[model samples]
Target: MEDINTPSTTGLMDRPAGPDYRLGAIPLAPERFSTWKERLAQWRALRDAPLYLEDGRARAARGAERHAKRRLSVHHATQYGHVFSNKRIPRDVQAAAMGRFEADLIALTPRRVLVLEVKNWSGQLKVAGDRWVQVQRSGAEVTHPNLLAHNREKLRALHRYLAHAGVNIPAERFHQAVIFVNPRLEIDPAIADHPAVLCMDDVGDVLGSGTSLGRHMAARLVQLLTDAETNATLAENLLKVIPPTEVAAATAAIKGLRTWDRLTLRGGRELQGDIIWLRLTGNQAPAAALKPGGAASLEWRRGVIGGIQWVLRNRGAGNLRGDIFWDQHLVPGRRVPLDADDCVYFHEPGEPKPSIIALSHVERLQIG
Candidate 1:
């Protein structure tokens, strides 16, 4: 709960008051980096770069000590397009949308905080509701998430965390909001039972509340986490809500097929049999055929079949310019021949690496 005396929280919504919503960040360090795997990875990334700069034959190189620097982090970028897409956004753009919320909370520096997940969608945002739509300047369309429901879920998590912290807070202080960035995109409006959301146009101004904790409080909670005992207790309690990540969640998600045991390929195959650690040799093309309501087929040029994707068909031909992967290994769903060997591996993103079944034999197929 928030009072006039209570510190404000970080809000990720857009601001109209001032465009300067830039925030300062505190760095995060891993618990430990001495693992052998980490060391090997670090070595591989730096192995080819020149170690010592060329200078005079003697110890003259020492004069350029200021030039010494640490290796740059090898970034891994994931383009988030699954939720929704439009011309305003590119297919490969990475949204630090969550980061916006995180930074805002950091500035708020509250003893307890609330996170409201809001979506400003017009259509019924439920299974049996109307479809919400967002029209970009280019006349392209996108959908907003069910922000009202999302905020409620977030509030629950925040309350759980706050209680465990022993930092007593109340429900009223936390809020949620979903705003249509532009008001011109009209829609029939409605309300919900929750008090967290604020439906508006360009919520950025309200989110960047221009509130900040002084240096002392901000720095104090910067690296705060639930104490060890609290964390352990939370771990046990969380098992009840969402099943553990290992096998439970996956099994529960799939319709009737539970991946209790591993899937083994019975048919005879060569080096391409193993699903993980596959060496892909295939031609990547700007062309491939697919049905209007079906998955786009991407042809592998060579080697063991690797992977396939259902891409946005907007490339060369009329319907088949999407980036679809045709892998050799049998990925659960339907199995069809990619080459004389590989097949399609159908899966939604974020599935754990399929167990690596022990592969046998050297080779039977012609592996390039």
Candidate 2:
């Protein structure tokens, strides 16, 4: 297990404090999907096969490459789980040929958008101008792809993709990092000194350092990535059946509906909707005639523009009659007109007091 200790920084944005406020998790091991395992097996089988077997060698190389990527992906999940796990933006996205470049991981923080390239090579590595060389354990030397050059192309393609999707992230805000996942690997002093190149251990310290503004920027970046990922997932689920214009309009409408004051209760429960019901735990009566049962219901209905009809109902035994005071105020028999942001409370007469159980709101209405 890799431990990442983030240094406390000043200027972080004010946010909710608690365990639930965290964005991601760190897993001890890389996730091994069936596809990755299959590729690994294929690579191992053909790696030392006949030299004349060109197709086998090529397949083996691809397998090795994918296996390395998988290992790095796992390492990253463990090392940066707190910052990246369960984030809105999907990591390790494989682009189609049309995208021109595939990314190992795309991380969006408040300050910048990071495109990471994971290289899991062992032994000694050196870079001379545009050339990258790797020396194996058996004293064998080989030239590998120029990761920086390759990532540059990927960055350009990503920009184009974002532009086409109507995202307006500036190029200056886009950054890149090449992570060498192998712990046993050694790098030439010149290449290791480069800012963009990092070993697995250095990732946490670098990202965790800096001022409060940097931390806030990271948080915002995470949000943007998450939103982008959500939109992409929605688009995929819709199968592109809906036109982009209509989809954008519908999305905007949904966002508008969510802009209401949320009701937070004891035990960390929250309710935000047009209709909320509170079930009391004990017997409470507003009046002698009205024997209150253990439940109170609140309803909000839209009337004229921003006007709200706030209705409160008390469930009790026998024929109910007369009005009762709700929160030291006269309760209307029908509905009380109030502002959208008005707060309401329910009181019960016994131990283990009243609590909000359910909330229901109209998100959308479909018309044929």
Candidate 3:
């Protein structure tokens, strides 16, 4: 929620409108997932507990944000301006029928503002008329909301919001895109080549292009800044239009959005952290003992073995390995705890090194 010009404020709009102010890179949050004491306690608790690898939808969403952040930072357009993530959707904008939402990423440059929706969905996907279908690696088909259409609506809402805020930019200057950041994702012919639907790899080309799609975008953004048209000036104008209290209100609403993985211990104690490394060595249920139905039929319980693994393995996963984040800072490396078996490394905010936890004592790990 920190602004590019100042980390103390929630939004860039909170700053005074100035013609010469500049914007800096707004990187992802830093390390220090848990307090030192909390990390020690988690380590001690896991000394004898079992580990269970669980996943959740929230975790995927958070990962997608990270992917988009990295991609945007390295792209050519980044030099033009900083990309903002989780830009809170104004209540007026939401009331105007954009629905309750937060922009996944907002690319603001001198000439244009690009609203991006980041999707981390993997596996095979296709379009079915108005609906989107997800063909899991297990061959089970799932229908998803029409995110493509929704993103367009969001762009429209943003245009309206900017107009109401008195920023007299053309509606054409605003753009929207749905970026699929997952490397494992496979798109059907229906949407694979859609202009607004892009893969992470295409981000650079799109941002740097001066063709029909970006003729008015990239070229305009690359133009030298004017004394009357600095990045801070536009940003300030946008902010100045909004009431000083508006930024605080929006930040409060979206600030505590928790995306960390949750660890629910057998003792009913829940801990928030990240699973750095994990191995699924638990015995699989016998063919006869396996549930008849898919994920729905499986009993999702804490400390139970194989339920999550079965689903992931069906989707071509042999084991689970993920980044560890403290607070929102991604932990470095994926190295396993030396000489550990049937154990996974866990990290909490403030913890420097990952703690080794036995797989037997862990009830379940809900990925954030």
Cα TM-score per model: 0.26, 0.34, 0.45
lDDT of 1 by residue, 91-135 (tens): 111432431111011001121132323232332322224444455
Residue 238 CA displacement from its true place in model 2, Å? 37
lDDT of 1 at 45: 26
Which candidate number maximizes TM-score? 3
Please, what are the lDDT tens digits per residue for candidate 3 over residues 193-283? 7888888888764454322324334333433343434533443454222121222332333333323555554444455555565433332
Which ranking of candidates, highest lDDT first?
3, 2, 1
RMSD of each: 25.9, 26.6, 21.8
True-structure lDDT of candidate 3: 0.51
Candidate 2 wrongly placed segments (more than 4 Å) = 1-99, 205-368
Candidate 2 residue pairs that clash: 10-212, 11-212, 88-226, 89-226, 108-221, 109-221, 110-217, 110-218, 110-221, 111-217
Q: RMSD to the native, candidate 3?
A: 21.8
Worst 10 residues of 2 by lDDT: 359-368
Candidate 3 residue-wise lDDT at 39: 32
lDDT winner between candidates 2 and 3: 3
**lDDT for predicted candidate 2 compared with the true structure:** 0.40
Ranking by TM-score: 3, 2, 1
lDDT of 2 by residue, 143-224 (tens): 9777877776666655555555555545765567787766778998777887888865665433432224433344444445
